[model samples]
Target: MAVRTPVKFYYDILSPYAWFGFEALCRYKKPWDLDLQLKPMNLGIIMKESGNTPPGMNPSKGSMLARDVQRVSEMMDLPYNPLEHFAKTVFIRGSLTTLKTLAACQIMYPDRLEEMTRQSWLGLYSRDIDITDKGNIIQFATAANIPDVDQLLAFSLGNEARQQLITNTNEAVESKCFGAPWFTVTNPKTGRREKFFGSDRIEMLGWVLGKEYVGHHPPQ
Candidate 1:
């Protein structure tokens, strides 16, 4: 019998690349028989602690990264819609709501976590809806067959839920995470742990898992 590989995926919704990476990872999950562990984090805290700056903090790098994102998405035929402006404060509150709801779903609608993650990404990027919007939050949760979205949202708004995200973010930083779309792959058999950064490394991840996969690699 083959071992089911466990992958810990850490991400922050503030990044468009994280959205791209998450979707691609999900698309590949079944084929890999992966046990995906999703962990949402605060990118700002990770950057500050890790002494890393946002890719776009430098105008030149920002332009290059913007192109890189567009190029990768177009080449891979992935979704590319992005929010016009960065959510100043709306991001923290909104993401906390989603993250807490995700925790709640783990108890009741475990199977729906993937769809909820995807919908959260769509709300910010594709749908032009801010995830901080309560209506959208309920809509996404309910769509995922969540039994009581109203209660989940109410719970997420509490101090406990907010602190949970902070704790998660702190844990991520401790793991040497400096950015979104970070992954820690653990081979169940050998118990080997490996860290990888970026959506661009998906090909490498497949190679490491010894899975027969294509399209993750760039053309030579």
Candidate 2:
């Protein structure tokens, strides 16, 4: 049997692009024979280490990026709202909290991680929900069948899961990852590394996974 390559999907919950990219990953899964391993990381740290500022901090560039993303979302039939409030809010805090929740969900019900991840991303970008809010957290968790939101919340408050998230973030940084929606494919047999940034390279991802890329052509 040929060994399957593992694709490490590094993302931050605050990233709308990650949500879009994840949907693409789901669509490309079977054709590529790819196994995705989700790694939730702190975007703030990743940005600092990479010497890259958040999009909101760069007004002109951020606006352009937002418009581009909106176009892509429309083309892909993905829900997206480019909110002005997102520029003013403390997104890092909410992102950290969401990562904690994901960690708890992963531990308690690993099978639900994909659904919970999708819901969490949609809850933030599509529905404009305050992801940091405890009530909103519970709502998303319950909808994703997270089992016990209260327990998950408690776990998020302490060191066990929080530390794990931190560790994961550190590992991502150590591995030279620079941003969310980054994909790292490791050859199961040869230990070779292949990395891609942004959602635009889904076709290349398909090629790496030995799958056919039959989706709509990515808008130039």
- lDDT, model 2, position 214: 77
- Please give the CA lDDT of all the candidate structures: 0.73, 0.77
Error of 2 at 2 (Å): 7.8
Tens-digit lDDT string for candidate 1 (2-96) = 55678888887667788778877877777787788787777778889999988877788877976787787777676676556654533334365
Off by over 4 Å in 1: 87-94, 106-108, 187-190, 216-220
- Tens digit of lDDT per residue, candidate 2, span 1-220? 5455567788887877788788888765554655777777788898899888877678787669878888989988987886557754445345777888887766767677788888888877888777878888888889888777788889888888887788878888887877778878864445678788888788887666555777854322
Query: Please, what is the TM-score per model?
Result: 0.85, 0.89
What overall lDDT, based on C-alpha atoms, would model 2 receive against the true structure?
A: 0.77
Model 1 residue pairs with clashes? none
Error of 2 at 153 (Å): 1.6
